[model samples]
Target: MYICAFMLILGLAFYFGWSAAYSAWTDMGVYAVSIMLICFGAFGTWTYYNIDKENKANAK
Candidate 1:
């Protein structure tokens, strides 16, 4: 569950950032994408950590 969430978050970040970076639109838009990457990246990392911990505890 957490892994899925993590993947989703990362996917969103990449999608947004890539699109913005490649786009010839305003610079502010690209900066917004960068912010999204940072925010989503953090959520993904923390969620994965919790998921791993839960799985390991269950295995023992």
Candidate 2:
């Protein structure tokens, strides 16, 4: 979960960096890939936290 959050932050930083460095927002392919990374990172983090919570509840 922490790793996923880190990845999400990293992805966001990378996207901003790429935009600043290359001005590639006009490119759809680049946008798609970058957005995908951010989305996946967010989703993974959310899923992990929810599963962990569920497991803890079941344990009791």
Candidate 3:
């Protein structure tokens, strides 16, 4: 749940970053933030799934 919230925030950050970058058409900072958000979100989602799987296994 916490990871999901983090991912949601990152997704919003990416949206805002991309919007800012698009408006300016050349802001490297926004691109960098977007990239970081993508990477972090992906890693976090993967970790969440792995942990969920482990919990299910333990329950079984």
lDDT of each: 0.67, 0.84, 0.73
Best candidate, TM-score: 2
Question: Per-candidate TM vs. native?
Answer: 0.48, 0.77, 0.58
Native-referenced Cα lDDT, model 3: 0.73
lDDT of 2 at 59: 100
lDDT by residue (tens digit), candidate 2, 1-60: 887888788878877888788987677766777788789889999999999999999999
**Residue lDDT tens for model 3, 1-60:** 567558658866776767776785456776667667666777777888899999999998
- In TM-score terms, candidate 1 sits at 0.48
Q: How close is candidate 2 to the true structure, as a TM-score?
A: 0.77
CA RMSD per model (angstroms)? 4.8, 1.6, 3.1
lDDT at position 56, candidate 1? 100
Question: Candidate 1, residues 1-60: lDDT per residue as tens digits?
Answer: 556566556656666666767874445655566556656666777777898999999999
Candidate 2 error regions (>4 Å): none
Pick by lDDT: which candidate is best? 2
Number of backbone-clashing residue pairs for each candidate, in the order shown: 0, 0, 0
